[model samples]
Target: MQDKDLPDIVDLVREMGAFGDGGRNRSPGNSNSGYGQGGEPQAKPAPGLPAQSQAAPDLPGHLEGLAARARTYVEAASSPNTRRAYAADWTHFTSWCRRQGLAPLPADPQVVGLYVTALAAGAADNAPGRAAPRSGGRKPHAVSTIERRLSALAWNYSQRGLTLDRKDRHIATVMAGIRNRHASPPRQKEALLPDDLIAMLETLDRGALRGLRDRAMLLIGFAGALRRSEIVGLDCGRDQTEDGRGWIEVLDGGLLVTLRGKTGWREVEIGRGSSDATCPVMALQTWLSLARIAHGPLFRRVTGHGKKVGSDRLNDQEIARLVKRAALAAGVRGDLPEGRRADLFAGHSLRAGLASSAEVEERHVQKQLGHASAEMTRKYQRRRDRFRINLTKAAGL
Candidate 1:
């Protein structure tokens, strides 16, 4: 039925005495007719509806509570890092809107299109009252970053029960134009091979508490192909902390790491290396023994001149810094300038290092990396045997 017909239908129902109070029992000037005995107007029944149909006083508050809970659930649906990025993106967009003297809400497609255009032109970088852009003066944002910001805006609108039509011509056409004009090739981190890893390891002071912890982290991260967050978020055992993302167990055979990653729960097996100096399992055990770390986060802060360990968990950014420092110290990429070499290595270098070095089958590598598809694992294999299949020759040239 058409929505416009609803009010007419209700009026008809009321006229037909569907409510079973046909007014036949009332007098010509009864109080039920919305008039007092003193001939003054009394409170009228709700228009075209019975008085019993009125909503309870608390119903609005109850619905608001449900809405608040729904918002909480939506926030919980994303990882903490994702939520944080989205929040920052929204704040940036809103700050830009303020500078432009526009409303951020109700999501006008034209305004959004203009906003993205400014991002592409680098105008948004210098928008007044906003913090200086991370890249310094007037550098346009990456296409990936622009796309993420758009997603953040859409999600923010949805949380407020508003619709943002990303498919609208204003948004879609501008985004397409931006992509055509500004998209660049993805920059992958330099993969650290086994030799390079050994060299980096050699740069550390093995006797120091910090050195042992860092050594264990690097080895475990490489062997397990673990992301930086997963490296530091791990506990000595399962269910140790509310924020812990995974845990590890030391066994006679190897080190078993159970992690809750983007793809959910998975186990990584890092077997004992050929030598005690290089074994990931041995390094972890040594670090644990020296640090007296029986529980809580596997990696932690080394305080008091690198002699004492702190109870707090280590930050993920430290992984990147450590990798860079060690890479520079070991002169892994001596051909490049010091600044360029430092920029090439990061936490992901360890994961990519293992992927590029493992001589096993593709499926084994994929499984070990906890990648749902072989294609994803291959992306991490920076130095894979590309010509192994010889598909061109096999096709009968």
Candidate 2:
């Protein structure tokens, strides 16, 4: 369908505040367990910090106003998801520092090294922080989590115009040692094959509105090879809502999904399937028509006893839960226990499923997935089914 064919549905916009500039101005030594007077947790100020106002006294009033507004844009530079994660990580780090009676700011190399070591040894987990101390005292973090924490620290420091010397021997040596000791092969999610997808779909009640939304989500997500965020971030049409990360357009023969992915903007073409039961386009159209989703988020909450649809978009976590629940109910891997099956399947399974199921060239798969390299796309081609050309058979033995 063309843009002019879109129905006139008013957008429901939600207000969101930008995350504090990584708590750049918060001091580490404020009492109340390192929190402000109002019981709100305070942040630590970076060392060598300059005056807060970017607007100088010498500037004109309007220019100064513009200068002040610049900080808001600066804070908005990072996405909310990213800022939230960084804030949590920062809070945890500061809390650890307070318990250790050490300084969190100035990005001290020796102290940072010790902090990372404690994380690897599980000692940091027990530190009094934003998160409650777990039942088990010392729970070591995974290599990936540790790395993310380090990146968070680096980003937080940069926000305050300070530099974290990650390359310093104290930090670098310990990281290398941690990798040598704790690194393991990456455990990938189990890819859902075409038959597996059909089985999972059978578990959902197609008669209900909730079922229609979910069925469309699963089918579209798999067919478009979309990420969980990409799936829920879609709008019925372009510019329908300010918050939508992407938009959809239905063509005569297929569906076109234009998204702002990690690799930037790209379009995914999902052609019509052989049957209505399995076709992603058909499923999406049915959901949209039944849900009355003329604009705004394509996938939304089904409220009022599964009879009514809400304007609020579904959380990305819902996608993961749905995939797991469906996979478990369908008994996708009958050989495995229920717990393992639940753990194995996730939102990424849909993307990986498409990568595994699509009988196409490597380059085509890579383009569809918007992967910068074929190696990245191949990583999603889980199981032995997608390994179509067997080199062993061609080589004379």
TM-score of each candidate structure, all chains considered together: 0.79, 0.82
lDDT tens digits, residues 173-279, model 1?
99999999899998999999999999999999998999999999999999999999999999999999978999988888998889999899999998999999999
Q: Find the 10 residues in a row with the least total lDDT in model 2.
A: 6-15
| RMSD to truth, every model | 13.1, 8.8
Alpha-carbon lDDT, every model:
0.78, 0.77
Itemize residue pairs with steric clashes in candidate 1: none
Q: Which structure among the candidates has the greatest lDDT?
A: 1
Q: How well does model 1 score by local distance difference test?
A: 0.78
